[model samples]
Target: MEIYVTIKGKVEPDKMAEFNGLFDLMVAGKTGAALETYGEDTFPAAESTLEKVLDKFEAAYDSINLESYTLEQGKLTLNFMGSYALEQILPDLQVWLLACGVKDVELEGNWV
Candidate 1:
């Protein structure tokens, strides 16, 4: 089966690279370093890591107003139209997002 996933968001032009790097570090289990580099004030290590990431993104990039994920079949496609930073990091970001909520995952066309 093929699945498509899409994500959308916005990021500050200056902090775009930081945002992408943070996401990559988080996914690689380098949360400690990420927190240190980005400062723990915004992205504190705690429950709901996804929420933390989102919160940090929002703070860093006030322009980020939309973040969405869509899945269809086995092909995972991420669309971060609003966020240029996210667009660059889509490949890794998708994998991390899926890991966040694996149980609630649903196949495309599968009705809840």
Candidate 2:
């Protein structure tokens, strides 16, 4: 099934640079300094966003394919092909968003 994941969040003015840096690096196929190499407590300070979340899923879950995404007005919509329950991943995604300096984040998933 195809899943349409809508992620709504705001990057504070202070965090916009960090978020943009991470997104740009990920989009450029540059996973700087092996992010996965960092321990739980040693994770880099780069803020997460749509790209980071999708990149994590792509690296960890071969079953999930992120086909497209759009970000506008603090809202991000991700279209992916996967067969997993959103409930299983929502919690972690929420935490990532919070750590990424995103305020009042909201997430929704629909099957179509």
Candidate 3:
């Protein structure tokens, strides 16, 4: 079984450098086992065990189909479907943006 999820968010175009840096970290393959998408547990230091969570997020972000995804101006949208549990990876999407905040998220298909 798999799920299709769409995430949308907003970020200042001026802050793209910071956003891209964080995003690049995820794609670079750093690994973290325990990290939260939001709240106090977010944004651990580079050496912190929780920091590896960025790796997990990058994998999921990379998994997004990208066929219908868009990131331009101040808007960002991504759509992808996979067997991975959304709870396991979806939060990573939100975590990528230090300034861009998620405005909406949609999920389709059945989940277990």
Tens digit of per-residue lDDT, candidate 3, span 25-92: 33343222322332123333322333433456465573333234555785766555555635576555
The candidate maximizing TM-score is 2
Q: What would the per-residue lDDT of candidate 1 be over residues 1-87, giving only the tens digit for each residue?
A: 222334433333454454555544544545454445554444333225454545555555622222333333322222333344443
Candidates ranked, most accurate by lDDT first: 2, 3, 1
Off by over 4 Å in 3: 17-68, 92-112
Which lDDT tens digits does candidate 2 get at residues 1-112?
Answer: 5456666677656545555554444444454443333212233442344345546566666323445554555554444345554445556666765765567777666666
> How accurate locally is residue 15 in candidate 2, as Cα lDDT from 0 to 100?
49
Q: Number of clashes in model 1?
A: 15
- Cα lDDT computed for each candidate against the true fold: 0.40, 0.52, 0.46
TM-score per prediction, in order, is 0.31, 0.55, 0.43
Question: Ten residues in a row with the worst lDDT in model 1?
Answer: 103-112
What's the true lDDT of residue 86 in model 3? Answer: 50
Predict model 1's lDDT versus the native: 0.40
Model with the higher lDDT, candidate 1 or 3? 3
The all-Cα superposition gives candidate 3 an RMSD in Å to the true structure of 7.3
